[model samples]
Target: GAGVSQTPSNKVTEKGKYVELRCDPISGHTALYWYRQSLGQGPEFLIYFQGTGAADDSGLPNDRFFAVRPEGSVSTLKIQRTERGDSAVYLCASSPGLGLSGANVLTFGAGSRLTVL
Candidate 1:
């Protein structure tokens, strides 16, 4: 099966600009998640989708960040009014959708590195 993947492995943008990052999850995986990792820090949960619905989105920092998983497969993270603080690595992961019953081991994509100027 194809593993999760992300594009633009690196992104450089000016402050206040908008950017959209994409993620493609593994085949047959129904649970997807997004997380942000700053330098020297662990990945922070951003949003997660179980099927077509977002099961948890509490980690979204602010209105500047948003995500969507329309078909319960591929997903995208959109950022608006980019700021230097927004610079970080955006990672996407997916699991077997069994929630607590499953191993919950998330297979992460390489991640998209965002740098705000």
Candidate 2:
């Protein structure tokens, strides 16, 4: 796809298991983000990366969740000790830049559905 891309569109895991979600953004995009959406709720921001560094990660629920953009392009989200409450759609987005001017503008990919049993 020309826009953002997410792998393993659907995932089912047992409680306490670990899972990883991947995202690939547009070629020239410099900003990437991860979001989580549970049933009947709005998407919640999880993390944001600019270039190869995490620009904002305060949204992450706890130390169990982490994300990385090793080369400033593709990113991966890792979840540890998965719980049923953690089940949600993981979304990936990218933009040309960050900050006030382009913060609201983003190209989002189809989310990854996760179910923890």
TM-score of each: 0.95, 0.95
Model 1 per-residue lDDT tens digits across residues 1-117? 488999879999999999999999999899999999999999999999999899999999999999999998999999999999999999999998846764778899999999999
User: Native-vs-model 2 lDDT?
Assistant: 0.94
List candidate 1 stretches off by more than 4 Å. Answer: none
Q: Which ten residues in a row have the lowest lDDT in candidate 1?
A: 96-105
Residues 1-117, model 2: lDDT tens digits: 598899999999999999999999988899999999998999899999999999889999999999999999999999999989899999999998987884548899999999999
In candidate 1, how many Å is residue 30 off? 0.5
- Candidate 2 displacement at residue 97 in angstroms: 0.6
Residue 94, model 2: Cα distance from true site in angstroms:
0.2
Off by over 4 Å in 2: 102-104
